[model samples]
Target: MRDFSQDIDWLSINTATIRKQHGQEVALNTLLDQCASAGIRAVSPWRDQVAAVGLNSIAAQIRAHGMALSGYCRGGFFPAADAAGLRAALDDNRRAIDEAKILDAPCLVMVVGALPGALDGQAHYHDIARARQEVLDGLAASLEYAREVGMPLAIEPLHPMQAADRACINTLEHALDMCDALDPDATGALGVALDVYHVWWDPKLQQQIVRAGAKRLLAYHVCDWLTPTRDLLLDRGMMGDGVVELKKIRQWVEAAGFRGYSEVEIFSERNWWQCSGEQTLQVCKQRHQTVV
Candidate 1:
């Protein structure tokens, strides 16, 4: 593995890690400025953050500061209730690919949707196998367009708790299985975004990392899982503060021929978000070196 203990040069901040402070949302432009001022060279931002501030302007800011995007946070929600909904989802994903190209992101990360309306408390379908198949159909269609656009699609397999709402493919093995089937030739057009927070608890973790190798491992995300995780949606621990075995996971990732930034992607509403962005980022650097 790379010697992160020496420096945090490869530490990229997923902007959501510090987008909220004291329970209030921070503006995207200000967030960019904060990252720049701290000498942080890269970030990954959500589509909503870009839309809230206007894409062209943020694109300008990224160029102005010579900043880089590790990946784009999110371009999927493929499973829908009907044909019209599915078509709309595909159309939106096309737009997201355009946005990722605009921002010069390395890959467009996808949190493939599940159970239709599960996030809104009512699941249109409770059959996870059906949801999984739909995700495949959606991805196959999206991958064709993504290849034409020259943007790699990174499937982010969310935590199993979110299998009903965020992502149906909840393991690196499962994500890689999907990739292998969709892009049988391993064409580099599709892959998985491996987040330690999501896959750390799996028994097959290291084996799957080895299976992903380099081509299928598109992006890497870092965040600790708190012992008593309060909220499944937001309560995330900073590196070194929890029992994720972060360094061990990094070792597996590196052994698989992957080399990239370990982008910190914490969403700690009850803890870190109560602090200033500067402090949060400073801690991110410290943790990236020592723990991750």
Candidate 2:
């Protein structure tokens, strides 16, 4: 594994980690400035945040700050209740690809959606197999456009707990399978974004990472998983505060040939979000060197 004790050259912050300061949304431009001032060389910003600040404006700000994107916020949620909905999802993803291109992101991380309306406490369909198929089809179509545009797509296999609403592709194995099926040669156009919080508990993680290898491992997100979590979606712990074996996993990832930025992507509602952005960022830097 690479030594991070000396400098944080390989570290990147997902803006969502500090997108909220004192429970308020921080503007994308402000977030970029904060990251630059903190010596963070890269980030991953969400589409909504970028849209709120205007795509061109945020791209200019990123350039001004000399910051690169580890990946774009997302371009998934393919499963839907009807044909019209599926078409709409694809259209939205194409636009997302365009936005990612404007931002010059390394890849567009996809959080493939599960049953439609599940996030609203009602699922349009309970057949998870159907949802997975839809994800596969959507990815196939999206990959065609992504390849043409030279934008890589990183399918993020969200945790199983989020399978009902967020993503049904809940394992690294499954994500890699999709990659193999869609981009048989591992051409770098389609791959997986491995997030520690989501996959830390998987028994097959190391083997799967080896299977993914360097070519298919496009993006890596890091955040500790809180024990006795308050909320499934928001209560993420900062590095070292929770039980995730950060170094061990990174060792596996690095051994498998992943050399990209270790992107910190925590979504804490009760803890880090309540603190100042500066504090959260400082802790991120400290944790990056000492623990991550």
Candidate 3:
């Protein structure tokens, strides 16, 4: 494993980690400048953020800072209420791919949606299997365009606790299975964005990482999971503050040939978000060196 303790050259901050700092939504350009000033060599910006600050402008800013994107923050949400909705989702994903191309992102990260309206307090359907099937179909269609554009798609399997709304594909194994089924040849265009906060609890995580190897492991996200969790969606811990074995998991990922950024992607509304973005990033840098 690479020695992060000495220098965090591979550290990348997923802008979401510090999006809401000091209880406010920090602007994308501001966040970008902060990340560069903090010596972060890479970032993963959400699509909405890029849209807010025009794609061309953000692309220019990223180039000015000489920073690279670990991955683009999102292009999946395939399951929908109807055919029209599914088509709409695919269209949006294509636009996302174009934007990712503009930003020169390494891959477009996917957060496959489940149950359509589940996140909004109600679900369009209760069948998890159907949602998974929809995701497979969606990826199949999107992968074709993604390949033509030479853009890679990285599916991010959210924690099972978020299965109802965030993502139906919750296991690394399941993500890879879909990858193999859709891409078949282990092409670089399809893979998974392995987030530790989601899969750290899986007993088979190490084995699954090995199975993914380098081709299927398109991106690697890092964040600790808090105990006595209050909000399942917003309560995330910074590294070392939670129970996740950060170093151990990184060892497994690296052993499997994943040589990429350890992108910090936390969604801590009550904790880190309440602090200054600078402070949160400083902690991210410190913990990344010592624990992650």
Q: List candidate 3 stretches off by more than 4 Å.
A: none
**TM-score of candidate 2 relative to the true fold:** 0.99
Clashing pairs in 2: 77-113
Enumerate residue pairs that collide in model 3: none
lDDT of 3 at 120: 94
> Candidate 1 lDDT, tens digit per residue, 36-100?
99889899999999999999999999999998888999998898999999999999999999999
TM-score of each model, in listed order: 0.99, 0.99, 0.99
Decreasing lDDT order of the candidates:
2, 3, 1
Which regions in candidate 2 have their CA more than 4 angstroms from the true location?
none
lDDT of each residue in 215-284, candidate 3, tens digit only:
9899999888788788988999999988999999999999999999999999999999999988998999
Candidate 2, run of 10 with poorest lDDT: 220-229
Off by over 4 Å in 1: none
Give the Cα error of residue 35 in candidate 3, in Å.
0.7
User: Which of 1 and 3 is the better model by lDDT?
Assistant: 3
Estimate, for each residue in 1-292, the C-alpha lDDT of model 2 and write its tens digit.
Answer: 8999998899999999999999999998898898898999999999999999899999999998888889998999999999999999999999999999999999999999999999999999999999999999999999999999999999999999999999999999999998999999988899999999999999999999999999999999998987889999999999999999999999999999999999999999999999988999999999999999
Better of 1 and 2 by lDDT: 2
| Candidate 1 displacement at residue 159 in angstroms | 1.0
